[model samples]
Target: MPRIIDSNDKNLIGDKVKALRKAKKMSQQTLSDRLETMAIYVCRGSISRIEDKSRTVTDIELYGISKVLETPIESFFES
Candidate 1:
């Protein structure tokens, strides 16, 4: 099957994720560790890719990110 892309980027939440993580003074590795506690196995490099909009995020990963950042999932799309 071919890949489908709706936007120029792989994901929509990359900038927001980066902003939120930085706001919390959290490193990519730290975020990865926190997500691990939730059984979400996104590694530091993946987290970097997520922030840079180079990776597609799964719903579960999104949920884990929101919980780790203490932000609602909706916030990821907010301006």
Candidate 2:
């Protein structure tokens, strides 16, 4: 089976992703589809996990998200 995250580690970008997705009125499936356009194929369940802080996201995925959401990578780090 594939590994996701260590039980103790949280997806740091989860909250940010959720907030931004909501602000853009995008659903998890929609976001996943958008990522696919950028050559990132994260499934809908994976996106739910990402937004819930239960899964890990790659740097490339972050890049794709930044582009699709039209948000700067820096925003993910903001408080």
Candidate 3:
């Protein structure tokens, strides 16, 4: 069967996430650890996948990412 989403990318904010994370000099494991504090569990491997656009992000995960990155959720969608 074919996939529901045709695009190769799994999420829209992956690139932005990578950019912001690097701008803050934050590592993937650090991001994951921080997210865990908010009760959002995304492992370092998963975060690497997210940054590579190979992982889907839930709403709650996105919220935790924004909080940890200190970025607005809308900014993730911005070009």
CA lDDT of each prediction against the hidden true structure: 0.94, 0.89, 0.96
Residue lDDT tens for model 3, 1-79: 9977789999999999999999999999999999999999999999999999999999999999999999999999999
lDDT of 1 by residue, 1-79 (tens): 6557665689999999999999999999999999999999999999999999999999999999999999999989989
Q: How much lDDT does candidate 2 score? A: 0.89
Candidate closest to the true structure, highest TM-score: 3
Supply the global lDDT for candidate 3: 0.96
Span of ten consecutive residues with least summed lDDT in model 3: 2-11
The lowest-lDDT stretch of 10 consecutive residues in candidate 2 is 2-11
Better of 2 and 3 by TM-score: 3
lDDT order of candidates, best first? Answer: 3, 1, 2
Quote the lDDT for 32 in model 1: 99
Model 2, which residues run further than 4 Å from truth?
Answer: 1-7
Q: What's the TM-score of each model vs. the native?
A: 0.90, 0.86, 0.92
